[model samples]
Target: MTDDAVPDLRASDADRERVAEILRDALAEGRLDMAEFEERLDATYQARTYGELAPITRDLPAGNGVAVPPVSLHKEPAPTEGWAGRIVGGEGSSTGAVAVMSGFQRKGRWTVPRKFTCFAFWGGGEIDLREADFADREVEINCIAIMGGMEVIVPPGVEVVVRGVGIMGGFDHREEGVPGDPGAPRVVVTGFAFWGGVGVERKETWAQRQRLKEERQRLKEERRREKLEREAGRRELDGSRHDLLGDLHGRHDPHRERRRGDTA
Candidate 1:
């Protein structure tokens, strides 16, 4: 009979571990992504009955000598994977942006041209290229900060080159020198900052960081709950063992039998 046939039966730690192993194997074979694997893993540990655990691996093949489907090894990598999808070469979304006394911001699904010129005079500006597409493989950003500062944000895996000259201010060279991933775009920041500064930074998109943070928190909380449950189970088992031993000793006591004979 299958586990589902006895769905109401209590599940042991062994049963849960078996299901967890299946999930892990599925993840190793690329059948499950990280998010799905972690979700199923959490469910496996939280399961208290056979019913709860069965659904976690309902579609997966049973492990332990069972023949699994053959994994394909000759599949070509998807063009949409990694940097290939990100480098969309075309005309830039916008040519130039200038901030006089207020501020200018360029972010969110915009395209960067080969030479993007931005000037900030007495007002700060921010250029975020984290989620932006590129018009070319190698593009240049010209920053002119006369009396206001400018900040340029690029995503990880991008190659940054800072060649801007700042008479009284300076351009940030911290993000430079790192080799970019294959097919990834290269960004060059060049221009002058007379009395203002230009800063470059590498950061992931906000949504990506938030998703990762939530996943970590979920895993942490699950671990804490599992720990508490284990401790409680151990205490219960110890108490049961102690009570059983006491009953056995009372039954086998010679003094109790002798007292019964005296009464007779």
Candidate 2:
């Protein structure tokens, strides 16, 4: 990719860092060899800006390397005990989160509210989310979403990663880790109508946030305990040193010999 393509895609310094992250994931997943990774990464670095990144993605080949599938969205309920209960919303609006994986080869737009998390996938292709619009809210796309073609947009302060075929891009939102068995599905090209959009509102339970906070607190408490233990050990050592000095002084004192002579 050269600096002369896609003149409108303005990316910041942080965006450049994300590009590196995408490349690293691709290399780790065996999508790209060391040499290719370095070459493309250098190209990206030299591009000067996001506008320069467009060409590299424009002429990329198919099978964008990784696999993305639209499996049923699942939610892991927050635990009933402690902090877990707080972040997990009440029973009324408790759906965990939404993930959309596709193999689309055409233009599509899904206007999302600022509160929800969105993930899009494409294969053998260059997909563009550079125009993805959002309000004043944070969104996270796990790095695995972009496998084939690459283009992602976000409001200022929103994060994004792009991975072309043989390159990996995106972020990981799940605290536990990437979910499920990794298997590539047969290539299926399915098309659909653009009508009423699919709406999903995932409410984070109070319990969930509570649990996260508690976990953090627990870590902090553990550190505190370790510090206290170390201090106690130091105090014990100091006391032992004092006792030893007192014993030595008593043994060396000439007053003890005078007392012994008087007793005799």
Candidate 3:
């Protein structure tokens, strides 16, 4: 049958398996969270026709086309490059920021010093490290805020240690202790806040996240091809065995008839 004619046909076990693989890839790439993945996975197995299976992964990258590919659950995540390039080990491009009654931001492709300090009084400041290089393996950021606020943003796969003290104020340390990438710098956040707040957040760069999604899709396609090859091999082996057995029976039957006739 033509490829275009198969959608209305009853979905086989293989069809359901393909859809399930696409869902698995989506979940791994963070396109879908656990709860959404579970719901779609259940629906995929319950689907009875190609039309039903097609919609399960229709919106996902893996299922953008008509075909749904298989993905290896055991595959390891792709590694980000070593941190040597990110650690310049020199003077910081900009040492710190101060906002007495305004706002200051230190971001972009700047160098972060080994010991960086920032203070905000009746104002606010922002420190972003998503694309910044580190001056040392271990960097300390000291922040002092009195009746003002500050925010620190770090990317995924970086160690963060928050040791800020807040008196009648708030210091965020929710992302502490998360494992970091190999050779990535360790960030120590130390600060004091009085009637003010300091917030720490973790985020991934948009480009990095997109690369991960594409990698997952590629792996899924490879696994699907492997599965199809395996199934084809099994079918060919079964056909050969059947033919061998039939040939043996045909040769024995003629001899048995001759023996019976001679005895009679």
Name the candidate that leads on TM-score.
Answer: 1
The Cα local distance difference test for each model comes to: 0.78, 0.37, 0.79
Of candidates 3 and 1, the better by lDDT = 3
What TM-score number comes out for model 3? 0.54
lDDT digits (tens) for residues 1-264 of candidate 2: 322332433344445545555655555556776677667665654443345554444433324531211111243222223212222222212111223444432123332333332233433222222233322222222222333332232212223322111222322222222111111011111121122111111222344345435644664575578679989999999999999999999998899989988999
Task: Judging by TM-score, tell me the better candidate of 1 and 2.
Answer: 1
- Misplaced by over 4 Å in model 1 are 1-82, 252-259
Cα misplacement distance, residue 80 of candidate 1 (Å): 8.2
Clashing pairs in 1: none
| Candidate ranking (lDDT, best to worst) | 3, 1, 2
CA lDDT of 105 in candidate 2? 28
After superposing candidate 3 on the true structure, give the runs of residues whose Cα lies further than 4 Å from its correct spot. Answer: 1-21, 24-80, 209-264
Question: Using TM-score as the measure, what is the rank order of every candidate, best first?
Answer: 1, 3, 2
